[model samples]
Target: MTTQQTFARRVFLVAGIYGIAALLPQYFMEAQVGRDFPPPISHPEYFYGFIGVALAWQLAFLLIAGDVRRYRLFMLPAVVEKLTWGLATLALYAQGRLAVFVVGFGLIDLTLAAFFLYAFHSTRAERG
Candidate 1:
């Protein structure tokens, strides 16, 4: 693999692992999160749904990592995936509606989005 491919692999792999580690526990943390964050998550469907979708994206990241070239087209949606959550959290944080802790996680996603973009650019030559 070239340097770009290596970087893409690492980026996606780390993102996947990190996402799983961070999100998986939330399935069991509904109560704790409600206690800590307040407002008590009135809708279980939305909360669990978000986690489910986010977790799915993480798996997709791993799939892309397995074959960056073959999945090059996927990088675009991956970037959007990161941005959706990252931007939402950061925007909420800016409005003073979210906690710093949440913003921190959002920043991570934003940073990864940037790297994802770079990775996509780097792999352009690999596209067949």
Candidate 2:
């Protein structure tokens, strides 16, 4: 594999691993998060649903990591996924609706989004 593809593979792999590590605990931390973040979760469904969908995307990231050339197309939505959460969180923080600490995760997502974009562009010569 070329250096670019290697970079993409590593990026996705790390993202997937990191996402799983971060999200999996939330399943059991609903109460703690509510206490720490304030305003107890009023809707359990939405909370778990978000975790489920996010967890699925993490799996998708791992899948893409397994085959960067073949799954290059998926990089697009992956970027979107990062951006949606990152931008929304940052926006909320800007509006004073979210804690400053949460901005760290948002920034991480945005950074990863940039890497994902670069990875996608870097593999343009690869066979789809």
Candidate 3:
């Protein structure tokens, strides 16, 4: 594989693994997370909805890994997904609503955002 392809593969791998790692714990420890929240979680809709969407994005990352060139355009949304959570979490932390430890997750998202942007730029459409 070309250097760009290799980088794309790595990006997808990191994103996919992080996504899984990030979401699975929430499934098993929902109560723990709720307790950790400065403001306890009351609505199940938003929490579960976030898990569902995050899981879907994990699948998207895997799909991109499967075909980086064909699915390249999808990376833009992926970037947005990462940044949205990252920035929001950071902003909450800034406002003193979120913990520093929780903000670590956002930092990971921001880190992934950079990789997503790189992969998105490196990807190219088929000439034919």
Candidate 4:
């Protein structure tokens, strides 16, 4: 209904989606790491580590979304991080050199990050 609530919901949804998606890479990495799988089969460790980081990032937002005010300190950093990733993804996509699915998902993330930033600023201003 309200802008704040909508933003919170969006954050939760994005975080949850990304968190779940991160797990899939682990399976792929496991299956192809040491076997005669593919060229990208030598770095399962790094992929697993990245999945861990993604999981943490997503869980943080999921935890904070319910009480954004209590976790206000994290808002700016989260927005900045997401925006940076989104822009990089967009740039890669624009060059016609990125995974199409990744690029499309990044576009959605970019939009959500922008909206979150706007909502955060507006809420802060209102409070001030």
lDDT of each: 0.95, 0.97, 0.85, 0.67
Candidate 3 displacement at residue 58 in angstroms: 0.4
Give the clashing residue pairs of candidate 1, or none.
none
Judged by whole-model lDDT over C-alpha atoms, candidate 4 comes out at 0.67
Model 4: lowest-lDDT 10 consecutive positions: 32-41
Candidate 2, superposed: residue stretches over 4 Å from native: none
Tens digits of lDDT, candidate 4, 1-128: 45775676567657657756855566555664445333454656676776677677777777667666666567677777578778998898889766677777677667767766765765574342
lDDT of 1: 0.95
Name the TM-score of candidate 1: 0.98
- Could you give candidate 2's per-residue lDDT for residues 1-128 as a string of tens digits? 89999999999999999999999999999999899998999999999999999999999999999999999999999999999999999899989999989999999999999999999999998775
TM-score of each: 0.98, 0.98, 0.92, 0.70
Residue-pair clashes per candidate, as listed?
0, 0, 0, 0
Q: What is the TM-score (0 to 1) of candidate 3?
A: 0.92
* Candidate order, TM-score descending: 2, 1, 3, 4
| Model 3 stretches astray by more than 4 angstroms | 125-128
Decide which is better by lDDT, 1 or 2.
2
Error of 1 at 91 (Å): 1.1
Question: What local lDDT score does residue 43 receive in model 1, on the 0 to 100 scale?
Answer: 98
lDDT of 3 at 48: 84
What lDDT score goes with residue 25 in model 2? Answer: 94
